[model samples]
Target: MRLLLLISRLDCLDELDALICNAFRRRGWEVIFGEINAIAADDYRCFTRGLLLPGSGEPCHPGPAALGNRETYFLDECQLVWVMSPPQDYAARDIWQMLWLASKRTAFVNSIEGMMFLDTKHALGYVLPKENRVFAYTSNDFSFLWERYRQASDQWWVAKPANAGCGQNVFLLPPNGPNVRTTLQCLTGNAVVQSLLYNGEVGAFKPEYTILQKFILEVANGEKRVVVVCGEAVAWYGREGNPDDHRSNIAQGGTPKSVELHSGEVKLAESIGLKLMEHGINFVGIDMAYPYIVELNIGYPNGLYNEMLTSGVDRSDRVAELIIASFENHCSLLR
Candidate 1:
């Protein structure tokens, strides 16, 4: 059977792509790699029916030479699709919608609907403990958050865009900070403002609408990244921000290091894994600061590659096996 990996392009993630491709190839599966634009344009239908083997250094066949007059190779022949890129703009969103509709008939690593829902940084509050939630959407909501912070005797707060990742545009707001009003004015659409969490404080807040949460200071050392695949917490590591910054995201100059999760931390990650499976998010990377979740990464998480390089623990084999098993189960159900 054929498995499709839908990506934006193959230039940037060469190492990661090679690992995944090799894993599936060793399992005797034909792997197809295609760009989102090409797939959205239905270009695969014009190609001959054949497996796109890994390390071949060739594009997908463009003419029907091996199998004649087959028009449904992508939709009918493929059993599973792993969407490995984020939809960053309107065109990408359209392509994602098309893939979402197609997923009704095929298995997907993480459903488009689930990705859209969980991709927002604020969605973690729904599954995490109440003390770890925070949300906001408007100026009025900021006022409500401020009032709650005041009532709780909090010293500082943090603001972040609800739909962003990699610690972009996140701000720390002290109670006496002069730019609170300006920051609130600059924010539009969905945002989250929460009391700074430190020293065992509950650190929760509320918006006039939606939910709000506390920002964990456990990040002072760094945050742990737990990679979960098909309801199992397989591999994990640590990420520390630059000395001058408080954010522990690798994109923001955070450094990755080997880490071991405590017993309680492992239990928490497994529990979150179970919940993510229920949402059809089988492959993801969860960032946490023991006892609190910082973010849930659904689109193209990359710690595994670095982890393998540094630690020599290649979890990609297990990830590929789980993906194959999930696809087999899904196909069997259809039959």
Candidate 2:
């Protein structure tokens, strides 16, 4: 029988995660769901340390010491371990490291390192052709970025954190905008001040780098998200920005809508999916504004549920089938 271990933050679990778990369980696969915080590593051994939810039944600690126990398995025992989220901080990083080490014995849907690489906006350079890539620059120095922004020919630009999502801290820089300087300072945390103590020492914190990209006017129309699974585009949808905002992220109040996929967009997504597959990243979300690819999401790339809701076509089952097919192929190669 096939076995799968799904790892995600319990507190962050949503309808999507539940759908995925049900998809696997319906196919007669043994599924174990747990939080990353419950995972522990002792030397080379990695296993969950708390109660885990089974495919169908009450939650129970999966060991001999548990009250209700069926079977026990280490990280290596599962046929596939799907890490649904990327490491966000120190604690998460530790858990991810353990999973990475255990990956030698069991497969992970998207390799931890691959997701981390795609999580950074810098990956756009490697994934998309220059003609279709957004014009952008990243720097931690306020003065350096300011100089480049001033020299740019475009009347409008965007500044955002290099590795943030959900449109947090994203800003539009209008030509000669009065608050440009303050915005840059705030984004980079470059404001300097003297110590309150009598010590009279002046200190300025090291700036956090931000991504500066030419604002594409087409984004005002909307941004499209393409979900690619197993090196193929499976679902597509659009997010329209609200009147007061330029970002089309649903988390930022943008609304999801059904849209026809342009032939060029489909081709672009297929080509990019092949490259991502080579890195062991099986699931991805490609964000686009017409011809230019704005960004990519490799860590729990969403939009499948929305697509199902809007188009009334449930691709989740197809996604599960493709993933299982890929897993079987990998196993055959090893054998």
Candidate 3:
């Protein structure tokens, strides 16, 4: 079967290709990398790339035409549209209409609506219940922060913008910093200062650039989990941080290692997968650090392809099988 993976082209995605594309090839199915651009669409009309994918309807093929603004467009050849990652423009624009359409048209690993939910670390406690989940301690305003810190001079707190992940614009306060309001404005439109989380070390708590969350000490498999409901564990890898640093996200210069999941971890991964399905998010890449779910890469998860090569396991083939199975299941119910 031919599948289309739409995403920005970047070197970080080497692992993804190794895991997915190589896997598909091994299964005797064709895998195609598709990047959709509106202007490029007009130039390549009615043209099919040399990728073979089969679905319930007919052999579906997709190309740049899948993206053009002919107002209404449909592809009979494309059985699935895998949005590995939306275009760079989409994030800056906040909302992407085509991505929404693709979700409706075909099986989206992680639907557009799903990205709207899990991309930000703010309001994480809301998505993650306080009962099973831990929240980064936070105060709504600067005055509350100053008063709280002064009461406990020995305590150190770190503040993060409402919505940021992957270590973006994180600030560490030195017990006291002037211009609380200005700091809030600069860091986040609305921000919070929260008590730092650590095992025993004391230097500065950046909270690893997401939420000021209550940290969990999970026994990780070295590689973080990226569970894809429509397929197998297509990829697994994470950055490794030394004592000086806590986060191991590859984007932060951590070394990559293959992750192996135990059966319980697999079940935990599946439960979260179903939760995402409840939110109309079927396919996702889960980041399980150690104890619980740390981050969810829903938009377009990269790195699996490369990891596949490293592990000699092709998750893409499994993903293709899962997609076919789901499609068949849907069609069967209709029949």
- Sorting all predicted structures by TM-score, with the top scorer first, yields 2, 1, 3
Query: What's the best-to-worst order under lDDT?
Result: 2, 1, 3
TM-score of 3: 0.65
Model 1 residue 300 CA deviation (Å) reads 3.0
lDDT string for model 1 (117-224, tens) is: 887665776767765443333233666655665564355567666666778778776766677655653443223434344333444443323223445567666788
Task: Give residue 114's error in model 2 in angstroms.
Answer: 0.4
Q: Which candidate comes out best when scored by TM-score?
A: 2
Encode model 2's per-residue lDDT on 204-303: one tens digit a residue: 3446888888888878878899999988899989997877777788898888899999788899888888889989988888898878888888875888
Give a tens-digit lDDT track for model 3, residues 30-138: 5555434431222332222223322222222222222112222232245555555555654434225545644555655456666766665553454554443544556
- What's the lDDT for all of these models? 0.66, 0.76, 0.50
lDDT leader: 2
Instruction: Give the runs in model 1 whose Cα sits over 4 Å from its true position.
Output: 41-51, 54-73, 131-154, 189-213
Stretches of model 2 off by over 4 angstroms after superposition: 1-7, 49-73, 191-204
lDDT of 1 at 184: 51
